[model samples]
Target chain A: MTEEIIIAGFGGQGVLSMGKILAYSGIMQDEEVSWMPSYGPEMRGGTANVMVILSSERISSPYLKVFDTAIILNQQSLDKFQDSVKPGGVLLYDPNGITIHPTRTDIEIFQIEGNKLAVDMGNAKISNMIVLGAFLKIKPIVKLDNVIAGLKKSLPDRYHHLIPLNREAITKGMNNLKPFLVAEMILK
Target chain B: MAELKLMKGNEALAEATIRAGADAYFGYPITPQTEVIEYLMEQQPEKRTGMIVLQAESELAAINMVYGAASTGKKVMTSSSSPGISLKQEGISYMAGAELPGVIVNVVRGGPGLGTIQPSQADYFQSVKGGGHGDYKLYVLAPASVQEMSDFVEDAFDIAFKYRAPVLILSDGIIGQMMEKVYLKDQKPRMTNDEIIEKYGNWATTGKKGRERNIITSLDLQSEKMEKRVHRLMKKYKQMEAEDLRFEKIACDDADYLIVAYGSSARISQKAVELARKKGIKVGLLRPITLFPFPKKALFDLANQVKGILSVELNAGQMVEDVRLSVEHKVPVEHFGRTGGIIHTPEEILEALEQKIINNGSIRHHKTRESSIL
Candidate 1:
């Protein structure tokens, strides 16, 4: 199966990093993957977005007008990409930052308090990891151990101390997402 | 050969250059093409193999530095995207006039004036025909896959040195950004500086000596000598046409409709061909791997066999003129494409083929009638 996801937010919000982590996870899973970013002036302070496509077979076009999933970290990003989600697809939103509710009934929306969960875990910047943890809950395509391994491979040896905190953030975020998923399943 | 590893196209290009015995890489950072410079910087091939890597002040300076390096018979290269490539045209012309061997990579982006930061095949004419002033031609190689991206660098460098001309890898943003598996080759041994001087010491400007006075200049004041020099360049081009024409033909023997495309557009066109076949149409693709010295003979042969030809590209009708020239009124040639960074979908191309080929209406009739009457 092929999964196409878009991770979008304001610059410095780790949107690109989240996309990279997913791409790395795909690589670990032995799936063909591509991570493409929006170039030019848009990368400065404007919307920074990346498209990550993971497939079992060869991928055709890297440019997608409609994405199967969108991980939005801010209200602007949610407003920007809500309309582009494919029918019956998934939309993961950081509830702490995003105030705008999705208007589409065709998509399944999951809201996580990513920033609050990360702050409670001691590293507020680990909001990206929190969202990733929620991603793992919704779509268990890659093992949590594989993600930890991917993160370890990406981080420098000098920054190894941060690994434990990151792991904690992920665990805490995953624990916080269970109630929501069960409720969503019951609603469905 | 080694195990295949997932790698970006620019990284593969850099790795391939090192394997191809490249001695120098000079370039500036540009979108889509920056990874090439980044890979070279991170790999630091020079400390291991004595290669030269320099981030020049501008694309102009980078190409001129390449000119200086190539004059000494060293395998030198530089890379950039559209606007930067436009800046390097003057240096490219100078290199052509002096008959130097070098490799250039153009990871093209949308353009006319910074049109977009997306992939584009609009630089077809700029790279195939001479973008730089003066009568010149670059041996342009278009690679569709990441594997081809790595493999073609060696071929481009070999052909450049064989004919004493510049070779260009014409790539787009998609190829630059996309990752795919590539098999890295074992490093090739390269010639030392002394060895290069010993071989091409006649014209290289290393330094002035008592007996070795090497001169490297493109200026030729004498009209007859300049004319003779141009003729020599033309002769080299003709030789390349005979020896270095590379293309791929897919199920084209009895193809009623021929789709002429290259690079990323060709990849999409291949899918279009499959869709056309499912609908009971005998469609095939003619993908030109080498854009310059364009596979005219292949198209000419196919023209007599195919009922119609469709030129597909990411840009609006750029390479279509060349396809038209090759067919030369023997068959109807139609063009379908998108511009300003929009990628053409396989469904859109199939739709055009259906209207122009399967339908085979007034357009084909008019062409056939005119040809018979003539």
Candidate 2:
């Protein structure tokens, strides 16, 4: 199956890096993946976004008019991409950054307190890792071991000591996502 | 043979230049092309190997440095994006006028100004028609993948030195940023400065000592001499046209419709071909790796066999004109594309091909619009 995802937030919110990690995960799975960033001036402290397409077949156009999933890190991202989500698709937003509830009833929305969870895990910067954990829970196209391996492969050698902390953050986020998983299973 | 590794187009090009035994790289950093410079800098070819890499202040300065390096019979290169490439036109024209051999890579981004950092094929006219001033042509190679990105650098340098002309690698941001597996050449092509001096040292200005005074210029005040010089350049172009044309054909031999495209556009067109085939339409693609020679003969031959031709691009209709010229208006040549930083999809191209070729509707709509607008 082909899955199109858009991760959007402010420049420093790790949205681009999140997209890159997803792309790298797709590559590890031997899937065709393309990550296209919004290279406009909006990249300078403004809202930054990236479009990623992971497909079993060859990907035609990297641009996405309709995305199957959207990871919104802030209110601006929620407002910007809320309507672009396909019907019956999923949207995962950060409750700490996005306060406004989505007005649409056709799509599934999951709000996670990513910053609080990462802070509890001892690093606020690991909020992206928390979101990624939630992403893997919702879409299990890649295994946890594979993602950990990808992280190790992508991270710089000097930062190798932080691997366990990152893994802890991912585990904490995954643990916090149990209620959503139970609700999704009940709906299914 | 070397092992294959995944690489971005920019990195692949840097590696290819090293393998091609480039004496020096003089370039400025620009979007979609910055990795080439980064690779050279971090790799530190000077200390590890014996290659020279310098980050210039501007595209103009970079190209001028290339001119100086090439004049010394050294294989040199520079790279930039569209806007920066616009700034280097003066130097390119000078290089062409002096008949110097050098390589320049234009990793294209969308723009007339500082428009956007997105990928675009908008510089088709500027590249094929000589972006610089006066009458001159560059040996232009359009690469679609990381594989071609590496391979074409060596090919461009070879054609440049063989013909004593400037060679251009015309690529867009998608090709520059995307990663793909590429197999590099095992051994680097050998070109020594001392060897070049031994061969062409008579004319090179090596401090103007111990030799007859040599003048490197493009100026000819006399009309007769100028006209003769232009003719000589024309002759070289004709020779290139005869000998150096390169292209890739996919399922075009017995097809009823032909898709003429290049660079990233060709990749999408290949998908369009597959979609059309599944729908029972005999479709194929003709991708030109060399934009200058235009692959006129190959396209003209295909024109006689195909019922129609579709010119696909990321710009308005630059390559369409060349296709029409090649076919001599024998068969209907239609155009389809998106401009202003928007990329054309395979579905869009398939829709156009179906409506025009299968349904046989108004194929000339875009052609008329292009002519009227131009």
Candidate 3:
């Protein structure tokens, strides 16, 4: 099995870290994974994107043209990668400040109010994890246990205290995921 | 069993430098490769393995420091990107002239002059064809994956000391910045001074005890003496070419066409090979692991079997010249690439193969394609 994903958003939104966590989780599950990020000037106060792949076999190319899933966190990312999602694929996004919505009818679209949820949870930094949890709920490609293990491995020892809170955020995200209205998408 | 961990390619190379028992690392921080020094400084290999990691003031200083450390028969290395690597060319030539054993890394970025910080393979001509101002060649190893980014450190050091020649790990920003699972070997201890004396005493300036005073210099005023020294350097390069050539072939047994590439381009082209095969096109990949001791013979043999070859790189066709020369223009060798930090996609590569190699025969060597078109 192979899953090619692109995670794109602002630099500080943990786009890279979310990809890293997914990569680590794939490792924890004994699968091959690659994480290739868009670096240089485009990362400073601009759009940041990372191409991530997880496969049972060895991954051929870390850089990809299209993705099986596109996890977008901003309107710019939505606009950039909406067409990049493969047909019959998944497009997950956090529609907090997004002015534009994805209009792809051939793909499954899911939306999460990640920023608002994180604000309600009293920790705005956990929004990425909530979005990740929403993705896991839809696909369940990686087990929750492996994700927690991946989080433990990626996070420093000093930040170990926040694992439980992050887990709660993830659970909340999974519980609150909403499918975008296909009818509304066509109208727009 | 080895330690399995997920690491960025630059970080893996840094950790491998420590684990490979390197004596010192002297490098200037450059984009796409700053993580090499960052990881080394954070890990503090000095505390762990008595190794030294210093942030040199400039690339020139860093390379000269490597030359100095390598003169003592110590396993030493430095890392930088394309522009910084260009700065160290003189020092690299000097080390080559002095027959110093050291590892230099160029995590290449797009460039003629500070072009971009994104990944590029434009330095192909500069690296394999001798960038420095001498007829000297570094044994260039192109690593395609993060695992090789880590593993080639040990292999490069071994080959460097074996030939008493400078070795370069020719990597690009994609491999430098990407993260993947890598198997790291156990830490090896650095050699003692006594061991250095025993191993490299004849050439290295390892204190010059109980023998004629060892002098290390690439300078010889007399023309005859300089000619003899150059011939000896040529001999060493020849020996490396004979014994140290490395390459990988995939699906070549039944291939009608071939793709020649190295480093990250090879990885991308491998996917293209797969895509082409899915459409019932018989294509293969030839990845030259060592660029200096290039797999010319392998390509020549494959040229006899394949109808055409597409040389894919992250540059505007540098290695294609080498590919043409390797096959002696027997096959239609065309180049397909994207320059200035844009990576070519696999679909585009296959499209180029169909268009440039299969369809378009009017470009060059039309006579060669006319006979092979059958």
Candidate 4:
């Protein structure tokens, strides 16, 4: 099975790093993966996005017309990529700044309160991990142990001590997810 | 087994540089390829393997530095993009004329001038057609994936030293910027100056010791002497064409149509080939890994089998010229390209294959439906 995902948010929100971590987790689980970031104009605090694919077989196109999952963090990304989520796919977003809620009835939509949770945890940088935690809780593509291992592998040695804090944020985000009004399916 | 790590194509190339036992890398920073020098600087190969990694003032200085290191019979490399590579033409021509061995990488961006920093294959004509002025041919290797970006570094050095000529790893921006899993080469110690002199010093510019002065010059004042040097260069290029051609044919054994592509275009065309196969169109892909060798024999053989061919690239049809030359117009060779850093999707290529090559005549009936009804 192949899972094509798009992680989009503000540039400094660790959008690219989030995708990189998931790709590393795929490697940790012995799966093939690819990570492609939108590296042109969005690199300077604008809306940033990255395409990530994890598959049991070799991945062909790193750029996809439609994605199985879209983790959106801002209103711009929500407006841009709301229609790009495939039917019966998952669209996870944090409701920190998104004004217009997604209205599609074909896919599963979840509003994850990662920003509030990060503020509550007194660390604002691990919000991406919280969204990642929500993604893992909703669709268990990779194990939590593998994700921790991926963090250990991806993070530099100086950032090693922050792994436990990031793990806590992920657990908090996983526990505090709010699904849409009508849920037809819960992938797990 | 070698360790597998996730790396960008440029980063993998840099890591592979240290692992390949190359003695020196002199590079200038350019978009989509700055990561190569960044990784090399971070690694500090000077401390690890006694290799030198110096950031030059410009691409010209970098290439000339590569030439100087290579003149001493040391394995050397430099990386750049399309515009920067243009500035390196003079140095490249000199090194090639002098027959120095080195590797040059062009993570090509779109161009006729200072083009976009995004991925583009517009350098196809410039690279395979000999960008520098001379009768010299540089072995050009096109890498489609990040893994090849890592592995081809070794192959480029080996081929360069074997023929005592410059080799180019011609990759586009997509492969350079995109990240993928790659297996790195095993670390090998950098060759000392004495080792280089003893092993490859026959024509090298190492000090003339225990022998007459070994001159490494490309200048011949007399026209007749220059013609003789040209003949030797031509002869060596001919030998390389005979032995070093490499191409990959996928699903072409029993196919009706063929898609000729290299590097990133090849990757997309492979997907298109599969999609066409599912539709029972019998399409296939022919990817040329070595562009200079041109894979003329393989294309000619396939031309005898396939009804038509579609050459897909990210440029405005450069390699298509080589394709037509290879098949000698045996089949209808069509070109599909997106210039100025525009990359066509797989669906677009598949549509072109269907419209321009497959279903236009052989796969579709051109007879009037009304006449058949009448």
Q: Output the number of the DockQ-best candidate.
A: 3
Tens digit per residue, CA lDDT, model 2, B70-157: 8877889999999999999999999888888899999999888987787899899999897888889988999988788999998998
Give a tens-digit lDDT track for model 1, residues A1-188: 88888888888878877877777777777887777677656678988888888888876555566788898888888888988788988888887755446667677788778888777766678998888888778887777877777677667699888877777776776777732242444566
Off by over 4 Å in 2: A1-4, A26-33, A53-61, A64-69, A75-96, A99-113, A178-188, B1-7, B180-190, B194-215, B221-228, B251-256, B271-283, B304-307, B351-360, B363-374
DockQ ranking, high to low: 3, 4, 1, 2
Per-residue lDDT for B252-359 in model 1, tens only?
Answer: 977988999998888778878876888888999999999988999899999888888999998878999999999887888888988888777677899998887657
DockQ of each: 0.28, 0.25, 0.88, 0.62
B289-321: candidate 4 lDDT, tens digit per residue? 999988999999998888889999998888999
Error of 3 at B231 (Å): 0.7
Clashing pairs in 2: none
Predicted candidate 2 versus true structure: per-residue lDDT over A1-113, tens digit per residue: 79989999888878877777777777678777777677666688899998888889877556556789998888888898998899989888887755565767787777677
lDDT of 2: 0.83
**Model 4 lDDT tens row, A1-188:** 78899999999998999999999999999999898887776878889999899999977667665889999999999999998899999999999986677888999899898888888889888899999999999989998889999999999999999999988978987898889744343322
Number of the top-ranking candidate, with lDDT as the measure = 3
Lowest lDDT 10-residue stretch of candidate 1 chain B: B197-206
Q: Report the error of model 2 at residue A138, Å.
A: 3.4
Report lDDT per candidate: 0.83, 0.83, 0.93, 0.88
TM-score of each: 0.85, 0.84, 0.98, 0.94
